[model samples]
Target: MTHGLHYTVNCSILLTDLPLLERPAAARSAGFDAVEFWWPFPEAVPSDAEVEGFVKAIEDAGVRLTGLNLAAGDMPAGDRGLVSWPGREKELRDNVDVVVEIGKRLGCRTFNALYGNRIDGVAPERQDEIAVANLAHAAHAVGTFGGQIVVEPVSGIEAYPLKTAADAVAVLDRVGADNVRLLADFYHLAVNGDDVPAVIAAHTGRVGHVQIADAPGRGAPGTGDLPLADWLGAIEAAGYAGLVGLEYKAAADPFAWLRG
Candidate 1:
């Protein structure tokens, strides 16, 4: 553990310099035994060969897959998620089985389900109804394998509605699924003006997973002004022992913070 916290490299965002399949080995070579990722596919359901190649890369890398995000629609195309989208329910539901199957193979029990952006022309209440229903569906699918689903509050996309821990938790409450929980991403929370320390103190029990990056710029720890170390300490003090994901944009050597 680094800094008294279990750190898992988020290969999805941090290791962009290499091809997707090569990232797990690079993270392993950097001394991280555990890794996490966003959906590493262009679509909700990838081909059988695509799935096999992804699983093989992680297996061959000798690292544990700790967390994985469910298919958040086309992320690079600014599709934050499908959970709350009006007509994309099937896409998200179809993706759940694939995510669970991959998790079963790689021993990952936590999954992040991004709440999609609010579309113009759709009533907010209507979107919320769909989100709650879809979230419950995903939760049951994962629960069958003893897995838990996490709903995250994203930053930087104004249309993406869940902006704070409270926002995400409200949705979780509505979903009313015991296995669905919050994904506390520190960078996003701070960027959206959350009370970081207080969030740790008040919601640790409800938090299923945690991720970190400095605010002002989603860069490595010290490149921005966030007191990440202190906040992580607060999380630990509050009885959170889950792996803290290093979900930042690398500015040179990503492992430099760990080494320092």
Candidate 2:
């Protein structure tokens, strides 16, 4: 089994809830070596200089900015995701590209691909087709920058169709790109009733990144009943040598809790 750990700065804690300027230092103080955000550069939001300064903060903090969830647009209200929206293709593509460029500037190499809401009257096979096509396009767009298009499967209210590791593998198979891989989120696995380590072991071939949170509460690593230490060991044992993002909320101050 492999024996090393690298933590990512999940935006849910490091950016989404806090102002962007405070994220990098907060992550570093929390003992994180890398950072990941769920859409850092929205078009209607900050300027290029502001975004670059954030990237500089990450570099100065000595943390590698690993990945970005590039699909926060479609889920505006509820039940929305990447492949679900019909005519937002151009906008979605643009948004994804904008973040990819920002991620490049921030020293990140992975852009997450999310499947949005379930469209009414669309067949499952058709959705798979759309997912495959969309992922292929997203992967190709990031491929030039030597970045990966990490496809994530959700199990909470966010889950629509591609909600399992096996399902995501199918999407990767269909997309047929080396740059595209599966993002196995532990909370999703637990909520979806999947055996966390087993799924990680099963998809070792295409698993690119892994995320962890408590089952039910989405709190810090050790807060849940899930056996994360062993599961983490299993993931490393199964040959997944990628970043495990701590995408959870802190019951207290994030850094204080970590230090304690």
* Candidate with best lDDT: 1
Please give the lDDT score for candidate 1.
0.91
- Per-residue alpha-carbon lDDT of model 1 for 1-260, expressed as tens digits? 23577889999998899999999999999999999999999989999999999999999999999999888887877889889998788888889989989989998999999989999999999999999999999899889889999999999999999999999989988989888999999999999999999899889999999999987889999888999998888888888888899999987788897777
User: Which runs of model 2 end up more than 4 angstroms from their true locations?
Assistant: 1-3, 14-17, 41-50, 74-76, 255-260
| CA RMSD of all predictions | 1.2, 2.7
Residue range 1-260, candidate 2, lDDT tens digits: 13476677786464456677677777776667778877655442457796677678778877787877775563546644565466766766776667667766776788887777666786766766776777778888788789898877787554477677887788788888998998888888788877776796678778889888876687876676887778888888788788888788776465454455
Stretches of candidate 1 above 4 Å error? 1-3
Q: List per-prediction Cα lDDT, in the order shown.
A: 0.91, 0.73
Q: How many steric overlaps are in each model, in order? A: 0, 5
